[model samples]
Every structure is written in structure tokens, then in C-alpha cells.
Target: MPRIPAVPDAEAGVVGRLVYRLARRRFGSVPEPFAVARHHRKLFWAALVSELGWERAATVLPATVREIAVYRTATVVGCSWCVDFGTMLQRLSGLDVDRLAHIDEYATSPLFSPAERLAIAYADAMTAQPMTVTDDQVAVLEREFGRAGLVELTQMIAVENMRARGNHALGITDQGFDAACAVPQGRSLDGSRTP
Candidate 1:
């Protein structure tokens, strides 16, 4: 359970009620983060709008790049929820999710491309405290993907760092978004989001 109780359906406002209905229809259930945010009505609605806005304005990077950077942050922060969700997102995008197990060995693994390795390295730098990002590292990224792309990449890594830490600090563990990919465990999805 979250620190606060969710705003129950019966008492929700017009906008909140509509969003809740839409969430249920689209995602099979309201994601716990949204439900938890609903405890603070304004924040809940703002978050919903923000996420929808992001969806409308497509991410500046490729799906694989964005997802990998997100996955790296989740892996570093020990946020099983992000990791689970990231894996599912990757799989759904038709990326090679099978090689995610080699993430820890990306430094020497041939599974990832040079560009991917650079992004993963950046994720690691940002994930580390007192980030050890070097001038040379930024130079390499600049050479690989000009100034705007570099800025976008850095911002994404920083954002993921915040998200992973926030979700982990809360009691939000893995919602098992990758239920089918890891194994065939017969667990109940009873209390989790269906998306």
C-alpha cells in the first residue's frame, strides 16, 4: 500500500473520474503509481496529463536507446518495477530483450553496439553518486550524436535516475510487467496493474 489511500471512485471529481475510467479501459487497471498519486488529487491529474503529453510528443531518441538507458538506471538503482516495465517495453518494441541478461557485462559484451554502450556508460555515470562523467566521455558522445542529441541523452539519464530512486524509495516493487519473458511462474496478478 502507498503512504496514503487512493481517492476512491465514488468520491472522485469529474475529470478524475473520467481519467480513472480511461485508465481502466486502456491499461486493464490503473497503474499503482497513478492510483498512489490520486491520493493527492491535483498531482494525480497533473501526472496523467504530463504522461499523455509525453506520449503525444514522441521521444527524441530511438525506442531502443531510450528503453536501454531506462533499463540501465533501473538496474543500477535496484528498482525491480522499472526493470520489469523496461523489459516489457523493449520486448514489445521487438528489441533483443534476450540479451538483457548481459547488461552487467556490456563493457566487454558484443551484444550491444558502440552507440548503445556509450549510452549505457552515460547511464552508469549518472547513476553513480558525484557522477564520474569525464570530459572525454562527453566528447565521445558529442562526436557520436551532435549537441542536441547529447543533451537529450543526458537529460533522459538524469530523469531516469530521479524516477528509479523515487519509485524505489516508495514501497513500489516490481509489478511483473515482464511476467512471460522471465519464467512461467503461476502467480496471481490479482492486486497488480494489468497493463
Candidate 2:
């Protein structure tokens, strides 16, 4: 259980209930973070709106590119909630979820393309404290993605860092997004690491 209990869908009043139901339908469950955020109703609405806006904006990047970067960032930060949610998103999008097993070795793994490896390396650098982002990393990212794409990638990684860290600090954990959500491909039934 989370440090904060999820606000039950049935008792969240009309607006909360509707929001909860809509998110549940879209995501296969109302994410635990969303439910906990309900304690601050106004902020919850803002967060929901902001998330939707980011989703629309990120469409400029291809699905595989965005998901791999996001997933790598989440894993680097050790956010189980983000990992679980990201795995489900990848599965729902029909990306190769099993390939994630090779992510930690992306530098040498053929499973990740050149683009993905670069993005993953950048995510790794940025996630580390006293960040190690180098000139070569920026140059490569800028060349591959252009300035705007680099900006998007940086913002997405930075945002995930904030989210993952916050969720970890708050004792907010996964809600079975990679198990109970839409037949997640690579998660064990007990939510353990699965090969």
C-alpha cells in the first residue's frame, strides 16, 4: 500500500469520479499517483491537463523513440511506478516490451537502434547526480534530433526525473500497471522482474 491511500473511484465526487473513470478506461487503471493527487483536487486537475498537453506535444517524436527515452529515464531513476506504467504503455503501443531486458546494455545491444542508444546514454548521464552530460553528448543529440527535438528530449527526461524522485520519496509505488494492465508482456504475475 502507498503512504497515501488512493482516493477510491466510487467516492471521489462527480468530477473526480469522472476523471478517475476516464483515466481508468484510457490507462487500464487510474494510476495511483493520480488518485493520491486527488487530495489536492485543484492540483490534480492541473496535472491531468498538463499530462494530456505533453502527450499531444510529444507526438512530434515517433512512438518508439519517445517510449524508449522515457523508459530508460524511469529505470535509471529506479522508479518502479514509472517503470510499471512505462512498460504498460509500451505494450499497449505494441512496441517490443521483451527488448527492455537489454536496456541496461543498450550501448552494445543490437536491440536498441543507434538513435535509441544515444537517447538512453543521455538519459543515463542526466539521471546521475552531479550530472555528467558532455559536449559530445549534446553535439550528437543536436545533430540527430535538431535543437527542438533535443529540447523535447531534455524536458521529458528532466520531468521524469522530478516525477520519479517525487514518487519514490512519497512511498508511492506501482499499481500493477505492468501486470493488471492490458496484458503486460514482460512482467511476472507477482510484479517481479521477468525475463
Candidate 3:
């Protein structure tokens, strides 16, 4: 259970209920964060809008690179909820989630591509306590991803940091999103199987 209890559907106002219904339709359940955020109406809407905006705006980098960096940040922060949700997202995107087992050895792991390694390393630097991000790291990322892509990468990492830390502090652990909705083998989010 979270340190702060999630608002039950009964107590959720009209807008909250509508949001919860939409969430359930989209994610198979209303995410605990949304339930908890419902307590503060303005902040809840702000967070919702911010999330949607980022989702639409963050299209510069390849999903694989962006997702790996976000997942690495979640692991580094030790946020179980973020890790669980990130895993589900990756799987839905048709990425190989099995390679996540080797994330600890990302620096030397053959599972990750060169671009993934760079992004993962950047995530580590950004998530460090004192923020160990370096000029060389940014320069290399810039050279690889260009200015627009680099910006999107940075924003994704920073956003994940905020989410992971917040969820950790709030005592929000994994809600089993990955296990609850298993995408069938070779199937995509649209229910179409890929070749």
C-alpha cells in the first residue's frame, strides 16, 4: 500500500470518475498515481496535461533509445512502480523486454546497442545524487542525436527522474501492470501480430 492511500472511485468526483474510466479503458486499470493525485484537483489536471503533452512532443528520438534511458533512470532511482510501468510500456512497443535482465551490465552487455549504451550512461549521470552529467557526455549525445533529439532525450530522462523520485517518496510500489496485461507473442498494442 502507498504511504498515501489512493482515492476510491466512490469518492472521486465527476471529473475524477471520468478520468478514471478513461484510464481503465486505456491501461486496463486506473494507475495508482492518478488515483492518489485526484486528491488535489488542480495538480491532478496539471500532471495529466503535462504527461499527455510530453507524450506527444517527445517524438524526436527513437522509442528504443528513449525508453531504455527512462527505464535505466527508474532502476537507478529504485522506484519499483516506474520500473514495472516502464517494462509494460517497452513490451507494448514490441521491444525485447528479456534484455532488461542484463541492464545491470549495460556498460558491457551485448544486449544493448551502442546508442542505447550512451543513453543509459546519460541516464545514470543525470540521476546521480550530485548529478554527474558531463560536458563530454552531452557533446557525444548531441553528435549522435542532434540538438532536437538530444533535447527530447534529456527531457525524457529528467521527467522519469521526477516520476521515480516522487513515486519512491510516496511509497508507491509496483502495481503489477506488466504481469496483469501480457501482450501475446508477436502481437502489438493494436492487437495485430507482427511478422
TM-score of 2: 0.88
**TM-scores across all candidates?**
0.81, 0.88, 0.90
Q: What TM-score should be assigned to candidate 3? A: 0.90
Clashing pairs in 1: none
Candidate 1 residue 75 C-alpha distance from true site, Å: 1.2
Residue-wise C-alpha lDDT for candidate 1, range 79-166, written one tens digit per residue: 6666777687688679999888777778889998888889898888877766779999999988987887687788777766776676
Listed per model in order, the count of residue pairs whose N, CA or C atoms clash below 3 Å is 0, 0, 0
Q: What is the lDDT of residue 119 in candidate 3?
A: 98
Candidate 1 has what TM-score?
Answer: 0.81
Superior candidate under TM-score, 1 versus 3: 3
Better of 1 and 2 by lDDT: 2
Per-residue CA lDDT of model 3 for 94-145, tens digit only, reads 9989988678689999999999999999998888877889999999999999
Off by over 4 Å in 2: 180-195
* lDDT string, candidate 2, 18-102, tens digits: 9888887898788988898888889888888988888789765667877888888777666778888989888988999888877
Among these predictions, the greatest TM-score belongs to 3
**Candidate 1: regions farther than 4 A off:** 3-8, 56-58, 180-195
